[model samples]
Target: MLATGLTFVAMNGIVRHLGTGLPAAENAFLRFAFGLPLFLPTLIPALRRGFPRDLWAGFALRGALHCLGVIGWFYAMAHISLAEVTAIGYVNPVLVTIGAALLMGERLSWRRMVAIGVALVGMLIVLRPGLRALGSGHLAQLCAAAMFAASYLIAKRLVERTSPAVAVAMMTATVTLALAPIAAAVWVPPEPWHYRWLLLAAGMGSLGHYFMARAFAVAPMTVTQPVTFLQLIWASLLGTIVFGDQVDLFVILGGGLMIGAVSYITWREAARRSPITPPIDVAKGA
Candidate 1:
């Protein structure tokens, strides 16, 4: 999970570094397109064994949803501070928990409900709609979070029936195809530097997804989700040091609150040996 967070933050930093040089859809498409090769070894073997027909719909759905999320995320990175993007993204886990309960029939305990409520409050603090004008970037991230949550919930189900490698590969392929038309509609030729940076971003993104899938294979999303909040700290430092973006105190405070709430649930689950929330093995390397 720690590896997942670091790799993803590194990818986000690269995307931020690229700024708006390329259209959001094109950038997202290329990220996955370049990363597609990384999964070929896994994909080839899975293809030889014959892809399961039953799982096609699930993969397609996850791919489309993830593509939308990535487009929004790329747009958000260009328009907002890295810390703000990460802070707003904290809502993903909360949305995931709700989806897990409603769609996957996971139990929703009172503690979890309370924790989720607190996390929502933290999100509100970060947005502060009335106090500050909500920009397109903020709204984009909110939509991205919802899409990501749905994609992750579908991934949780898919991983049960397929290897993580195949899941990641198929998702990459599908998203690349899905983004092709959107990217072409507003396509702008990228410079050589753009390709190089996006390639690096692609590698980081592939690694992040692999690490996340491995984590999911061994533990429930709730167990692994909170650990990702650590990225907020990394993103804050990176934004401040590298980008010279001013750190918003509200973002930090709200992110800290959300992290605390989720961390509390993780701790309580481990302490009580809750059936709904299983114990995680951090050393297990997911």
Candidate 2:
């Protein structure tokens, strides 16, 4: 999980660097395009084993949600500091909690509701709505978080019926195809050198998620999920070193509140679900 957090921050830095030149839509499309080859080995085996035909549509929908998240995330990265983007993104798990309640018929407890409220307060503090105007970047990140939450929920459902490898592979392929037309429409052919950067970003993202999946596979969510808070610190450090962005205390404070809320909610849910069975961890930004 620590490695996953570091790699995810690294990937975000690369995205910010690349997005300075590339259209976000094109960048998103390229991410999945280049990353698809990495998943081919896993995807091929899953294809041979086969899953219900009905689930393909769910995968496609999840892919589309992922595409939206990617587009918004890339756009946000280009326009905002890495720390700011990372902090606002912590709301994802909160949103995911709500989604599970609504979609999966999980019981919504008062503790979870209060945690969600606290998270929203933290978000407002980070945004400082009345004090400073919200930038498009902030709005985009918020939208991206919600989209990611939705994608996570759908992926969770799909995972019940199929392997994680298959869910991931289908999402990659579907997102690549879905975004291709838009990417091509606005696509400025990147310099030959840029492909190297894209490949690096893709590699980091793929490996990060792979490690994250492995961590969750081996450990309980109660143990693994809390470690994801390290991502905000990593993002803050990377922003300072790589991008020369200052670490905003407000962002840290706000993100800390959200992380605490998420952690508590996750623990509560895990305890409620089963004392014996390990709970599934929430997906983090990649």
Candidate 3:
């Protein structure tokens, strides 16, 4: 999980560096372009044997939604401090818990509700939108989180019917193809320096995803979800050391409440569900 966090931070650094020159949509497309080759090795096996039509649809929808989320996220990352963006992004899990209850008809317990409420309080601490109010960077982070939550909910449905590897590969392929035309329309000649940052962005993204895939393979959702929360800590550290970003007391307090809330929700979910083997939860950026 720590590896995942760092790679993603590295990815943000690369994106922030590159977005100064290129369009965000184009940068994201380059990421998928570089990433496309990586998928073929895993995709061939999944293709020899096919999944149901419904599963394919699920894969497509999840990928499309997530691609938009990534666009929003990359745009946000380009403008914000790592900690500020990431602190706001932690709300994705809370969004996921609510999505599960509403869309998937999962049972909602009072504990989960309270946890979400507390987490909201944490978010308010981080945002403080009223006095010395919200800025564009912060708004972008919040939007990214909301969009990512939508993707995860769609993904939960997809994973139930297909392997995570196949699902991931297919989604990457679909979104890559989806972005090709847009990238072509806005394509600009790239500088040598731009390619370096773009390479780092793409590499970190691919590597971060690889670790995330491995983390999911090893543990169930109940186990892995909490591990992913370590992002906030790493984000803060990176922000301070690398960029000299300020540490807000609200961030610590709010993030603590949010993490505690998510932990509570996960615990309640584990207690309610059967002990049968199931796929792990895959959390991503807001």
Candidate 4:
């Protein structure tokens, strides 16, 4: 999870860099196009096995959700500070947790409820309503976060039934196909340097999603979600170092609160799963 967070932050940084003059749809299409090579071997075998109608539908839905997220993320990163984008992206985990409870029938304890409440407060602290008018970037990021959460949850379930490689390959292929028309409509031919950056972004995203799928396959969402907060820290640093963006104290504080809430929720979850020690059977021991 930590590695996934680091790679995702790096990818997002590259995305922001490449987003400067490129339309978001084109940037998104380019990402999947470049990443396609990594999945060709796996995708080929998966397709040879015969693409069932249901499988195709599932992949299409997943791809559409991811495509929406990629477009929003690209647009937001181009217009807003990376830290702001990352902070807003934190909402993904919150949505995932709720979705798990409501849709997947996962248990949601009062402890988790309190944690979520704290996280919501953190979001308010970061956004600080009325202090500044909300912009397109913030709205885009919010939409991206929600779509990403839904996509991730679907991927997690799909991973249980399919190989991670196949799941990722299908998503990549579908998203690439879905974005083609939109990208063509707004396409501005990119410079060689832009392709280089975007290609690297695609590589990082491919690696990140592979690890993410494997993680979800091995663990429940509750077990893996908290570690994502690390991305916010990495993004804040990247924004400052790479883009010369200023770090606002309020954002840090809010992020800290969210991290704290996630940590407590994780701890509670772990405690629940720990083996109970049987009372010492001193009376029975001879």
- How well does candidate 4 score on lDDT at residue 170? 89
Task: Kindly list the per-residue Cα lDDT of model 2 for residues 1-286, writing each as its tens digit.
Answer: 7898888888998898876698999998888899999999988887787766689789889889989998999999999999999988877766776777787776566876897799889888788888988999999999999998888778767766665666777888889998999899999989987899899998898777677555644443334545677688888888898888987989989988888886877677677764533455445322
Candidates' lDDT values, in order? 0.90, 0.80, 0.72, 0.87
User: Candidate 1, after superposition: displacement of residue 216 in Å?
Assistant: 1.1
Q: Any idea what lDDT model 2 has?
A: 0.80
Better of 2 and 4 by TM-score: 4
Off by over 4 Å in 2: 212-226, 263-276, 279-286
Pairwise lDDT winner, candidates 1 and 2: 1
Give a tens-digit lDDT track for model 4, residues 213-232: 87777666766778999888
- In candidate 3, which residue ranges exceed 4 Å CA deviation? 1-3, 48-51, 105-108, 210-223, 264-286
TM-scores, in order shown?
0.95, 0.87, 0.83, 0.93
- Give the C-alpha lDDT of model 3: 0.72
Report how far residue 188 has shifted in candidate 2, in Å: 0.6
Model 3 residue 23 lDDT?
68
Per residue, candidate 3 scores C-alpha lDDT tens digits across 1-286 of: 5687779877876676565477667777888777767778878878788877877777778777777777778778777777767778878867876777788776556876787788889888888877666777677677778877877677666655555566667777877877778768888878888777776677787777667555545444334545567778877887788777788888888887788787776766668774533444444311
Q: Write the per-residue lDDT of candidate 1 for residues 89-188, one digit (tens) a residue.
A: 9889888888888888877788889999999999988999899999899899889999999999999988877878789998999999999999999999
Best by TM-score: 1
Q: Which of the predicted structures, 2 or 3, would earn the higher lDDT when compared with the native? A: 2
